[model samples]
Target: MLIDPHLLAVFTVTTIVALVTPGPDMLFVLGCGVRGGARAGLLATVGVITGDALYIAAAAGGLAVLLTAFPVVFTALRIVGGAYLIYLGVQMIRNRKKGQTDDPAAGGMSGRRAFLNGMVSSMANPQTFTFMVAFLPQFIDPAAGPIWLQFLVLGAILIVLEFVADGTVGVLAGRIGGWLRARQAVRRRIDAATGSVFIALGIRLAAER
Candidate 1:
């Protein structure tokens, strides 16, 4: 609330970009949506936001210093996260021959299970921690107000924006997936699309500095 106007604008723009960009979280949500349905997708979105909130608070509180002090730790975490993503992608791709036929009557995930999976997926990635530590403080105006409060305000904005953007993607992808599941050809392509997205995300994460 006490942020400078120009700084707030810049921060909003940057946050929007970050939210809209399809990262592992978004791709994961998309995959969930396609595989599980809209409800699962939305639940996953909630989970991702929860993780982002934790990282934001941690960064505001001083975890950022620890990250800065140990460069190797961050890099190691990134590599692990990247590899994990690739593993998931490869598993999905390899399982195609194992009868992944989509059932029109297929049930979606339960709320609790979906939320838990989403939370684990979001929190397991070290890249998320790195992103929070690196990105949130750039717009902090020490003179505007208590630093933590400012971070909370800004972080809240990010979470809300992300929920809207990611939520929409999840819902839409789920619906489209639902429609395509009834078609054999479309189902095959959907599976491939999902796996490719994950693989590409993993490669990008591994390559990032």
Candidate 2:
């Protein structure tokens, strides 16, 4: 077997719990859904999945360890990623204030832009790389047929779990957005709130070691 049955079961449970727990990824999806509608949120989820996939591959390929060995690179990623998030948040805030467009706050993004934004959010997410480096390996059994294969399997499982969990969040958040869209006062407040959340998330990510 590429992985031990017992270990695989435990990994599944642990990963489910991890994905269920509200993290940056989940929150990001929720915010996107609230702002961009269900489709936008799902696209963001896909982008996040893509980023996580890359990180998983990197972790399996020893990039995680190499990153650990070189603190400079990791630190650089943290700073850059954090800054990027902050930039996105600020732009959202500015766009809302400009009052120049008839588009809904969530309506402004095209699928391509949303997907790209999601990709950026996920890829640059400090937690993305760190989680891959810190987690998953613990379940790896050196005796397994091949470590890379095991990692790949585990990574696939994680992606599936995250999609289900985050997808639900996106869908539900879209509902909330639709409801809020009907009430101008509520919609305005929600728009501002979403932007604030993004800023807060960005700052939190930036400060995390």
Candidate 3:
């Protein structure tokens, strides 16, 4: 992934915006970190990166054709993904607890489990894939380089940004898990807020063509 100045600026700006936005992915990672630990959260971050890389490849490839060819399939995927996000949000709302002691079981989520959870959550959200398909082409310059190569470069930038942001949140969550547990009301509010974001993002995604 060659990072030219222009591309770097665009990539950096987009990444910054995306990283700051709290979404299903962010909430999941934060929750996992608080529940499991930094190691688990890091593993989950890797899983999500894997999913992002896969989508990048898929978008660079001809998979967009499949989506474009079958609009209904894309719609179905959006509906399913949206529903899953809502379900996850509801779970967060229900699970928020205040003034709880640190339970080792809760923090013992295996790295493999974290990785799988991250990958599955990312894969289930068809909007990510669709967004890749839609957004990538605009930045691509076939005369500048191979389309696939350009895409890989762009995707790598996104992943690096994602890792830095999500990883930071995970580490921070690990450090503050105890404190957060003591503040049940705050946890509840965070959960509720994150849930609302997920529902809103899902709705926006579903409304997209």
Per-residue lDDT tens digits of candidate 1, residues 154-203?
88998999899888988897898888766766666666777787677777
Q: What's the true lDDT of residue 3 in model 2?
A: 80
Q: Which segments of model 1 are wrong by more than 4 Å?
A: 97-102, 105-131
TM-score, candidate 2, is 0.90
Highest lDDT model number: 2
Candidate 3 minimal-lDDT segment of 10 residues: 98-107
- What's model 3's TM-score? 0.72
Please report how far candidate 2 places residue 205 from its true position, in Å: 1.2
The stretch of ten residues in a row with the least summed lDDT in candidate 1 is 100-109
Q: After superposition, which runs of candidate 3 have C-alpha atoms over 4 Å from their true positions?
A: 1-4, 74-103, 106-108, 178-209
lDDT of every model, 2 decimals: 0.75, 0.77, 0.69
lDDT string, candidate 3, 1-209, tens digits: 34457866886797688677986567667766665567777887887778878889877887777877887876786677667666655666666553334543332346897687677667556656765888777777777878888888888888888999888887787566645534555555655665565556556555655
Return the candidate ranking by lDDT, descending: 2, 1, 3
